[model samples]
Target: MINKVQILSVTLPGNLDAYIRIANLWPMLSIEEEKSLTQRLRYNSDLDAAKKLILSHLRFVIHISRNYSGYGLPQADLIQEGNIGLMKAVRRFNPEIGVRLVSFAVHWIKSEIHEYVLRNWRIVKVATTKSQRKLFFNLRKTKKRLGWFNEEEIKIVAKELGVSSKDVREMESRMAAQDVTFNPLPEEDFVDGKNNNTIQYLQDKTSNFACRVEKDNWEEHATNKLSNALLGLDKRSRDIIYARWLDKNQKNTLQTIANNYGISAERVRQLEKNAMKKLRIAIEA
Candidate 1:
């Protein structure tokens, strides 16, 4: 068996030929050998056993990472990410589970590669939420043809995936979209002298320094006035306002506040309305 240093010396190759040559060095492990090594690592924390387990699986990582080549990322990077997942799987593997390590590790391997693709595939993130991520990965596999899905096809996919048709359409659009550089090169000029790049045209005018300063000053003044008005209120009214609005995590409903104060919900509502009126008057004054 190859030692840890020998295994570490092996570098991921740029071309297929070199990769194949390096992969040939690490032989696959037999079932008995694999079980023994895993058991040693699990019971004794044997570093050598863990090293052998990981080394034997490096070729498998290469094989799995190749499936993600369509994402336009470097194959070496994908394999590197998959190797991380493989090591994690090795650490968590149970020899008594009656499953081959490869069978269990495949999920971990693909997940790392998938995360890498999602993170680096586009300049802007295509999928942020759990449902969006599910839609993003499954959309390609579910498509019958190469082109965009038609209206009927979209509905079928939406129903099958338990998401809205609008969400399906949005994910399809995102999948079809390509990343564009935020700033264009100097030579990439339009027919007119003005640059046509998004950076030049898409800037938010309201985000200018002077405008931001003016907005901040107005907010500060309003906040100061509100604070003074709250101080002028009676204790009960102040507490009600705090519980209902000002407390970030504990905004109480009218019924809850009423229960606490031994009053009806309607009475609480009336007091809240009256307090708000007083606040408006105080701020205006």
Candidate 2:
């Protein structure tokens, strides 16, 4: 009996509050009205019928979006994503299935909102697997207190959710961990652009990448020279150098080398010094 889009000529307000007010002001459709609109859109591709169904459901999307406010994403974004879900539900609704549009649309609405929450809730995703995702959304409600879960509580939650206690603890730890600010804020104490033991080192500058590349290149270059220098030495000298510095165990003392060579420790030390000088000269050359 009423033209739903009467305010089409009126430019919609750009603010969230005004958009929510408009959504709330939209009148709810009757059962018969909804069925007729759904049938028209489903059978004949009636654009006006689809538009009415979507407009009537915006308030429902806003209601569902409010449930995710704890996630700290923008309210407008949540509602916008939920509205997409509502549209999808409307597109797939079959009148012969004998279910209310609201009943069918709730799943679609929450699905979009859940995806939005997971994607933007944190800098790093806390839930990746099926079990972790279940923990992410339901763990908040299962939590009985304001602090970390005790051993008994963890076991209870794990049993209740059908997940391991380790998983529960891991998810809880992930939830408790706050994102670190990579760069120093303007108010941070930087002495000559340096902050000691701070997250300032986490800043991903282009220069830092270049420095790492250069360091790797120099180390590789030095390793090549050292390998060539070792080859130039006599068998005994090479064995002495390898036993002294290149041995991973670090158990080859001067006396151990001398014992194997049947020479005095002093002789071993002098040979080491002479071999190191020759290697240095060969490397620098």
Best by TM-score: 1
- Quote each prediction's TM-score: 0.66, 0.63
Local distance difference test, per candidate? 0.85, 0.84
- Assess candidate 1 and give its TM-score to the true structure: 0.66
**On residues 76-148, what C-alpha lDDT tens digit does candidate 1 reach at each position?**
8898888888877888899999999999999899888888988998889998898998898788777635468
With a 3 Å backbone cut-off (N, CA, C), the pairs that clash in candidate 1 are none
The prediction achieving the highest lDDT against the true structure is: 1
- After best superposition, candidate 2 residue 239: deviation in angstroms? 40
Off by more than 4 A, model 1: 1-16, 144-146, 191-194, 205-285
Give lDDT tens digits, candidate 2, residues 55-106: 8988998888988887778898888889878878888888779888999999
Report the lDDT of model 1 for residue 102.
98
C-alpha displacement of 214 in model 1, angstroms?
Answer: 7.9
**RMSD per model, one decimal:** 13.2, 14.6
